[model samples]
Target chain A: MVNRMILANVLHRPIRTAVSVLAVAIEVGMVMLVVGLCHGLVNESAKRVEGVGADILVQPPQSSFLFGLSQAPMPMKVGERLEEIPHVLAVTPVLFVVNSVANLSVIYGVDMTSFDRVSGGFVYHAGGPFQAPYDILVDDVYAKANRVKVGQTLNLLSHEFRVAGIVEHGKGARLFIPLATAEDLQGVQDRASIFFVKCTDPAYGDDAAQAIHKLLPKHSVLPIKDYLSLMTSNNLPGLNYFISAMIAIAVAIGFLVIFLSMYTTITERTREIGILKSLGASKRYIIANILREATLLAAVGILAGYGGSLIARRAILAAFPTLSVELTWDWRFYAASLALIGSLLGAFYPALRAAQLDPVDALAYE
Target chain B: MEPIISTKGLKKIFRIGKVDVPALRGVDLRVQEGEFVAVVGPSGCGKSTLLHVLGGLTSPTEGHVLVDGNDFRGMSDADRTRFRRHKIGFVFQRYNLLPTLTARHNISIATHIQGNGFNPHRFQAVTSMLGITEKLEHRPYALSGGEQQRVAIARAVICEPKILLADEPTGNLDTENSQIVLDMMRELNRTFRQTILMITHNLEAAAVADRIIRMRDGRIISD
Candidate 1:
């Protein structure tokens, strides 16, 4: 009966309930979207790292952020020296440059023969491998999104190149060209971005990395597994703080909305509360009633927020294909739990006020 | 027989912006078990204040209230709340039924507040006696004034409290509805041996009680 009363009370004030639910939904949706994007980023970065299929990666010391993008160019001759290391089967030098023309596109320049050897080679979906100096390969997703097909000419860094082939999804970069061509175009002929070193045996990766680190102590030599772990753990600078701030904002939004709504509701029901007290309702009973209402509202809001977030993810990916938004179950659960906690906290003060009202005065209240 | 309620020198002062206005002044009163006592007075005569104090809804400024031999003055606020839930039931002039709940739910909530589940037999007996069984599904707004007041009375007595406190339970009803509510209270008192303390300005309403006490300016003028 008390539960029914709570449900009835929520339905009695439609506008207030709607506003509260909408506020919670918005907060949950924001958290879902932000966390989803964060997960997507982590997943995409890990996939890119693993895609290299390298036992060890050597890059300039400071390039530990964003998959070595921040690193200064290392000398291409580092690959030749790494090839001299024991248990090192192949060494491929690659350059990565971010071009901001029609959104950010990562351009990778790789030595095709050594890249295929070190990175298990790519599976072509259309056309054939790079045939000319300026030939390029675009991944399936990017090719379809941008409407680029085989034999089509596309511009990167104000230089035009024919799309030589289409690679399988998650193969490598959206745009891959010959190593010398990218170096010449970027005016860094003798510089390479990073070196991918494949060990003769999988178990020798850690040993090979340690040996390379000894030779070039000024640079970072990390096994591929360690780099992937770093990305998944969100140890990157500013990333953890950014995620924490987004979660805090989401919680605040949920808290403030529920607080205002429940507070006003308790104020409006002051006389009713007084009557309930007169009839022998304890403070715990009153608080339980208020909390039950809040929980119901949060439950509805979470369901709606989950649906809205899924739709938002679809819309976001539709508009910006490059921006990955992964709506994973873990992120959704986190959003729901945070929203529930926030709303319950928000309703606490109002429930306490309701329970503390003087029954005599409340009954006499007009 | 032991007195179900007793108050000695009960005083209640209202501080209106630092001005001490006395609402109850050294009033002594007692009602025995199973007694139906009516307190009658003009407005601002502290009739309601005395009822509130006796019901444990408010504390006296300087007095001792003993209900069923339990000293109310010594009990904490939380203790008083628990005491009221277990021992007292109240009917308000406004028919303080939860507007959002059905008549049945409003009555059932009284039991729920007691931390005891509903007793189907007691529910049937009360609703049947009050003639509210058919109207149980209707919310308060859909009920007539007489029906709403009856539902309120039913809610008050559903838990079989030792004492029932009523503050002008018929103030909002028409003459016919008022009489019906009064008769229900009289019937409840007679049938269940329930003790009742009612505050009212209506002499006819007071006449239905076993005894009437009149108050003037916060003191009992006559009994």
Candidate 2:
């Protein structure tokens, strides 16, 4: 009966209930978007790193594997030296460059022969293998978005190149060209951004990375698995804090809105609360009534938020074709729980106030 | 026989800006079990305050209240709340029925708060006796004043509490409705053998009770 009364009370003022539900829904939606974007970025980064299929990445000492954009480039000769080491089957030197057109695009320049030996060769959707110096490869998503096709010429850093092939999505970089061509365009000859070292056995990746670290004591040698762990765990500099702040802000918005709404509701029902007390309602009974109302509102908000987030993800992907926004079940469950917990916390004080109201004074309230 | 409701030298004071305004000034009273007692007084004569104290809604400033052999002063707030749920029923002048619930739900809510699920037999008997069985599905707004009050009465007595405290139950009703409500209360008192303490200012309404206690300036003047 108390539960029914609570539901009826929530429906009693439809406008207020709608507003509260909307507020919670918006907060949950925003949190889901933020969390989804973070997870998508991490997952995509790990995929790209794993796509390299290298046992170890050797870069400048202070460089980060997250962006892979280091001002100081490593010498291409480092690959030859790494290949001389035992258990190192193949070595590929790649140049990482960021091109600014309408938006920032990451470009990878690789020696096709050794790159394919170290990393499994790319699977082409349109055409196969680069034949000319300026032949380029693009992912399917990028190709579709940019309307690029085989036998079409595209510009990269004021240099024109023919589209050699369109690879499957998630295969490699959005833009890929010959290492010599990238070196010519960037005016950085005989130097590469990083070295990808493949071991004879996949299980020897850790040993290979340690050996590389010893050989090139001045440079950084990181195992691919470690880089992935760092990205997923949010241990990268300032990333964890940024995600935490976004989550905190989302929870605060939900909590404050629910708290104010329930507090005002309790105040408006002061006389009714007194009447309940006079009817032999315990404090727990009163609290349960208020919380039941809040929980119902939160449940509606959570469902709305989940639906809204799916639509938002589609809209976002359509607007920004290059960006990845992952809406996993884990994140959806997390968003719903956060909203419910925030709303319950918000109702706590108001429920307490209702329970503490003096029956005589409350009944006398006009 | 021991009194169902007893207060010894009960006093209640309201503090307004450091001024202690006495509402119930050291009044001792008792009503035997199964008796319908009416307290008649003018506005501000402390009849409502006395009722509030007796119902355990408010505590006395300087005296103790013993209802059905349990001292309210010896119980904590939570304990008093439990005590009231099991032992006391209250009817207010405003008809205090939850507007969002049907008459049946309002009546059943009392049993719910008492931690007992609805008893269909007692509910049917009470609503049938109060002549509100046909109006059970209607919300309070759809009911007439007399019907609303009867629903309120059914709600108050549904749990079969040991004592019933009514604060001006008919203060807002017309003479016809007031008489009808008063007659129902008298019938309920006789049928259930439950003690009832009512506060009112109407002499005719007081006539239905087994005894009338009149008050003046927060003190009983005539019985």
Candidate 3:
């Protein structure tokens, strides 16, 4: 511990020390940004899949084929027959189309009553919740973009619709309406894209979906949980590999920044380290000193980055308001990981050289 | 009946890339309790290496250094380090005080690290004896070279270590400062019966000690 106190003293180099701290802060900031984006991606996918919350979605096999082929909607009859399933709780048929509500703007529609049961609370940023049929619920993102507000009447597809609420969900501009209104717009049999079903018991969802699929061999029934899980799990084929590659790149960049900062600091303080070793200080003491400095810098850097990322989170959400951005306060993860990595990589050469310092040669070094 | 320090066939061979430079050859030396011995040598003549080996600052490539009948070689590095902290005190040419710390704190750190209880009375006495009382609160950079060396000496002896090893304590100072440092070393040897081994290239400095050993080319040439 001879040079422990001495090495602690040297951590106060004004400009160099601040630059090292900022380097750590920048690395942590970048990491926060990446983690936040990943969370946002997962959240956005889940919100979109479960948006109108049907326990099982029924679509005509041909309709599925058309949409799968050209991203087009199926005729609205498949939703009409889904109520025949024994376990079916509610069958809210949704007509998917890109059509204007009178003279105002293009909108997407879902059955109001079933939408209320499932994805209704997904829009907490607007006026109350969806109530009456033909009462459209617009996503807050589109509302802001179109400068529309709560209780405003919007015309779509040669019909007048009142804006019941503005929802903040994950991605895409959606305007929901009743199945009845959608049928009136496009002639009952030709407009419904999918049927959204809610099972009385959510746990029996997969079985109910299977039974419904068997009932109508030409129709596809998809459970909300299955669809949402597939959309959100991140481990799809090559997706995780891509995300892993990106994280690896971020971490590599962080390591380089920390290494150079610590290396430069070590080079600058070679003489001081030498002098301390000569004063009966052990190699272990010198290494511990460097570790302590790195840990301290990492702590400050992580906190700064976290605070800055909060502002960044707000900005990103504003840019893509449909996204449900998840911000985790798992500060300990970042702090501990950065501290361990910083000390491991940042203090390696410096501590080695500091330990290997021959007091006789070190004293003579100018 | 006991010598405070003794060494037999002490040698240090430094391996630099391919060449083995012998820093110290087989040498025998003895210092009785309370004796102040000065080792004088030319530059690169191995006196400092001998002091280092004797004080347990380093292990010798060959031979044995015995302090108070315990062999320096038999102990582990950790045990040796504790031995060095409790039994040895070092004073170097450049003072080697940490520039960021005040003189009092510098001395206190060495004492504290050894787990030696702080004696405010001893602190006051040591600072007064070394004539560093007024400069105790000042950092090394703020003090003169002579004052800094005095602080270094205070740091070394504060722990009441069994042996004091000073390497060219006044090599960076003027004659007046050198005299002041030497006078303090002599007073410490007299008052506390502290065994002192000082290494220097200056014969004038070595002459003040009770015994003088001269070394050349890593071997003791005369005693």
The numbered model that scores best in DockQ is 1
Q: Give all TM-scores, in the order shown.
A: 0.96, 0.95, 0.81
List lDDT for all candidates, in order.
0.87, 0.87, 0.71
- Candidate 3 chain B lDDT trough over 10 residues, lowest sum: B76-85
Candidate 3 Cα errors over 4 Å, as ranges: A1-11, A48-53, A59-75, A87-89, A94-138, A145-193, A199-207, A217-220, A236-239, A274-279, A318-320, A331-339, B73-80, B116-121
Q: Candidates 1 and 2: which is better by TM-score?
A: 1
> Would you list the clashing residue pairs of candidate 1?
A63-A71
Error of 1 at A138 (Å): 1.0
Fnat per candidate: 0.96, 0.85, 0.08
DockQ of each: 0.88, 0.84, 0.24
Candidate 2 chain B TM? 0.98
